[model samples]
Target: MQAIVVEQITKSYGAKGAVKALDGISLSVAKGELFGIIGPDGAGKTSLLRILATLILPDAGEAYLQNLHVVRDYKRLRSLLGYMPGRFSLYQDLSVQENLSFFAAVFGTRIEDNYDLIKDIYVQLEPFKNRRAGALSGGMKQKLALCCALIHKPEVLLLDEPGTGVDPVSRKEFWDMLQRLKSWGITILVSTPNMDEAELCDRVALLHNGRILAMDTPAGIRGSYERPLFAVRSDEMYRLIQDLRQWPGAYSCYAFGEYAHLALQQSLQGFDTQADSVMAELQQYLESRHHTGIEVLRAEPGVEDCFIASTKDR
Candidate 1:
């Protein structure tokens, strides 16, 4: 059974219909599956989550959580889903235990009644149980927020960029905790801007500018990349890009890390004379003009590389 189903979901804001936050987005999360929405800032991930959580209504389309209509049965839906918003929305003045208790109470439950559901996470906060949530570290606050969300034992979890603002170590630990949570048969739908985190999900949808570029497993997405790319770097970086772009056979070129990734227009041309012929001509042209320290090597495409390539195509 599908835990969550969104069909043709769309949202917009401003008087002139200025911003289109979500645009005809449709997706489904299977029961007990970990689905990810991978996108950068302002990609409408939060807007979609809010709609699913029944905190916001979509301008069009419909959504269901565990077969319950999000809009029609919002009151009942609230009792069956856990949501951790992008921002830390927990009360700062409340102690860790108090916040958990309050959220549990809201759903007609007590901390003790569901302590086993969150014991692994709650213990870490137990040492600071009496401390005000405002004074906790970024990682600790993340943990507390999650505990509160899970206190009611919801069937689905919606997390929006849960790793943002936390240290790398804490981010890794948080994802590890999510893996453990999956064994409990709770469906998880998480949104993140980090490319590395996208690999952890069972499947991911890459979003850009309120549109989905692709949706598939990490390996499957990577396997779809077909072009041969090269990383070219030089001490005279500006001149290298300028010269490379002007090269006759170059199809596309862009800066990546410390090197410029270049896609050639023609691949069959041998690098020895045809490809190297162009490079040597450019090198000599550069050397004649007093350029120095050029390096170019063939490189395999990574997730970031594929993302850039896909965006460029769009």
Candidate 2:
């Protein structure tokens, strides 16, 4: 069954609707699949997740959870949905175990009833079960939150920016747990501003400006870039950016980690967009300007590369 479905949903806020958080957004997820909504902050990822979890209604259009209308049957839908918002929202004074028990109680279930569902996660928190949630480290608190969200054995999980502030190792661990949950037949929809995290999903929707720029598997999105790309680096990074922008044949040059990925201009008069041709041109331009230790090689496009290209016009 389709686990979730959204149709042309739109949302706006502030007086006179000055802010449009979501714009004509529509998508779906299948049961037992891990789906990701990838975007940066203020891209409306949280708003879309909230609407799916039945926390708020859209200004236009509608959504569904497991075929149940989100607005009309929110009470029953809440029972079957697990939501971990971007923030650590558990009670500050409640101990890890107490918070777990409380959430289960609200769902008319007990820790013992859903022990298997959260055992792996809860085990890490077991030693710190007596510690107040606020006193725990960021990773630990995130784990506790995930445990609470799963206590009821919800069929679908909505996690918004769950890895935003956690460490790299903890981030990996949390995603590992999510894969295990998918194995248990739970539909997962995760949102994040991290471009690299797009690879973790079975499929992803690249969102920007409250709209979806592209939707496909990670490889599919990267493969959509229509120009030859290269990772170019010289002794001086800042000067390289300035020089590349003036090359006239350069399509886009943005710093990415230790190197800059440049998309050379397309096939136009006096310019050859072929990979080797563009590489040669870039090499000559940099060498003329006394650029030393120059390294220019073809770069395979990734999520970030595709995101920039997709958003170039929009």
Best by lDDT: 2
Deviation in Å, model 2, residue 95 alpha carbon: 1.0
Q: RMSD, each candidate, Å?
A: 3.1, 2.1
lDDT for 85 in candidate 1 is: 96
The TM-score measured for candidate 1 stands at 0.88
Q: Residue by residue across 1-314, what tens digits does model 2's lDDT show?
A: 88988999999989987999999999988999999999989999999999998988899988998998999999999899999999999998999989999999998999999899999998999999999999999999899999999999999999999998999999999999999999899999999999999999999999998999999999899878787778989999999988988898888899999998888677333434355676777799999989999999778889999999888856
**After superposition, which runs of candidate 2 have C-alpha atoms over 4 Å from their true positions?**
267-274
Q: Score residue 256 of candidate 2 by CA lDDT.
A: 91
Weakest 10 consecutive residues of candidate 2 by summed lDDT:
267-276
Question: Candidate 2's error at 256, in angstroms?
Answer: 0.4
| Clash totals, every prediction | 0, 0
lDDT agreement with native, every candidate: 0.86, 0.91
